[model samples]
Target: MSRRSLARFVALAAILSMFGTSAAVMPAQAADQVIKIGIDLPVSGADASDGIPTQNGAALAVDEANAHAPKGIKFAVDALDDAVGGVHNPQQGATNIRSLAADPAVMGVVGPFNSNVAAAEIPVSNESGLPLISPSNTNPTLTKTAKYRTAHPNEITYFRVCATDDVQGKAGAEFAKTLGLKKVYIIDDNETYGLGLANVFEKDFKEMGGAVLGHDHITANQQDFKALLTKVAATKPDAVYYGGTTSTGGGLVRQQMGAAGMDPAKVKYEGGDGISDAEFIKVAGDAANNSYYTVAAPNAAKSASAQAFINAYKAKYHSDIGAYSANGYVAAQVIIAAAEKAIKANGGKAPTRAQVLKNIQNTSGFKSIIGTFGFDKNGDTTSPVIALWTIKNGAQDFVHQINVSTK
Candidate 1:
């Protein structure tokens, strides 16, 4: 061959090699396009204790999903703080939900930790056909209401990964009764969650031959609980049940009682999941010791899968995962798994909100970092477990995992 002809052949070979290399890189690059999941939780302000951990858990799940890259589909989390301005603000919750729902890239949402927020966001979410799985919203009214069922039949996009307050309150009451606590002073924050749980505890405790010494109401933002504490102290009850978030509950536990002139060890202060956060330690200080609270058992980090998740979370974020972090992570897992299932069923197309909702409802016996998770017809987890914890040395230490008798 002539010199010019040989050079032309070499150039053609070089062009083909470049094309081959480009084709090889395209698939990996295509896999990098992530499916975004919306995370609406309280990352700051009053509810940050629960909301931040919930967000962290969701982030952990997103990281795992991306690392595993199931079916070449990457997962991305878009976190929004519902309690950015303050806690228990329905308007802020609605705003956050609307903002997330407006994003076409967001296939589903992982939170809105407060039941009141869930109540507010349900209508907006239903209108947008957005599937929202809450890790902590346990109010029965969210799913059981006739209005909610009528408006969102077959398309019920709201689901919870934890047991409702009915179960939580009953379990808590039973636990206290077992401890031989006869007279209990009950207090609530007046919000949907606080009031609802308080009612449940009151009814159950009464039924179990326990006496209600007194009942009081407290606002969410009130820092001065001395008046209520004084009343409770006067009652001389065996235990004080606080139905509110850690922000108020912890402060009341620390400042109102204990070294602040009240005998902390003499009276047991019990609360629901709201007071189960580590912030309770900071707020309650030494009073946190021996303080008992109830929370979703599935959120514990003791299981093998949970420990794995915690390790991965720590490795990625270099921080301690909070109380509800594992539950939120599992919530994200449910959403992502459903999305993947829907996508596969739709012949590699991204899932529709409706399809994803169905997938979430039908999802059963799936292994998660929080153990087995599956929802029943009422949008409640089938294996709902409640755990009691006590504050020890300014930290929440697992005490007993309450086996839920109710479905």
Candidate 2:
């Protein structure tokens, strides 16, 4: 059966008839089991542009999972907002995970796109043995921490389908090297993702034998970037790398870079996945052109599966897909796949939280719209590929692929 076929999932439903033969392993409340996957996202705030698409992709995955749910279990989603006033709040993210952990029905969670939010959410999720799978969190520290732990506990079960900032930032730096751009200035949004990405870029760019002019951090959602842009202009560097998202002043930085007389093409501009959203093009207008960004998800225009998702997404939401849509979809797929494996291992009985988490951590060769990928020992995707994009005509167009490594 085709993996993408929604009807194919109903085959699992057929297993319901066979469950009666395995009564010894069935849980006491098996008849009332309702499997749920919690979605924590910044659906209403600053990340709404990316968050909405992330949620849309996840919703589709949930629909498919339910269509294929095994007997005695009804699959559903318990989506919650982790945003406050349209911005990701670490505290809110933590609270959302705690609530999900408290729910007995929730089998796993997919969300908290922002890296800073994931940092807060991880500890809470680990405490309750809830596996938190992120569709967009890319800070390398989460998985790259010293053996057994970094800032988090050894029992942490956080995982991500997206490429971490170390890989993405290195791609950006390498792309800059190809452009022969020297003397680059770095600016970040002062958040976990942004700063972490900036640091990686700075290190990689310099290591590539390029000159690093300076670096600084900016406030999130600030309208005025003229002063910073002016400083960047004074340096007259070959490029300005802003490690931030559209919601975190990426557009203003792009716009002001142009307004400050920094030629978009000559000086060049680059950012990590944070600024790759359509909103960046909208917010920066003509100035967005010629800018560069890196994304973990493959280009939808090139992948057939991605094209199908794009069409379905447009039909359902009447909106174009975002950079993180495929990531979110795959995140849900991973969780659903793990749950399926756990269910089978339990002889058609519902699996425990630990079982589900273990299955996810050991996932390998899972196929999805973006392509086939699996989690390594660190709970990060085994795929080390990152796609680069360029802005043209107020849209992010796929440029090419870049293989990156993190030190």
Q: What is the per-residue lDDT of model 1 for residues 1-407, given as tens digits with 9 covering 90 to 100? A: 99999999999999999899888878554544468899988878767867876788898788777766656577788888777455656778889889988887788899888888888888888888888888888778887764554455656778888878888899889889877799999988888888899999999999999999988888757777776777677778888888878755545555577543457777888888888776777777777776788886554666776777788778877888877788788889898888888878877777777788788889899887666768877677778888877777777788777557453
Clashes of each: 0, 3
lDDT over C-alpha atoms for residue 180 of model 2: 78
Compare the candidates by lDDT and give the number of the best one. Answer: 2
- For residue 77, what is the lDDT in candidate 2? 85
Per-residue alpha-carbon lDDT of candidate 2 for residues 130-204, written as tens digits (9 for 90 to 100):
888888888988777733243346665888887888778888988888867888999999999999999999999
Q: In candidate 2, which residue pairs get closer than 3 Å at backbone N, Cα or C atoms, i.e. clash?
A: 9-68, 45-86, 46-86
Candidate 2, backbone clash total: 3
Please, what is the TM-score per model? 0.88, 0.87
Backbone clashes in model 1, listed as residue pairs: none
- For model 1, the stretches where C-alpha displacement exceeds 4 angstroms are 1-33, 70-72, 86-88, 147-150, 258-261, 405-407
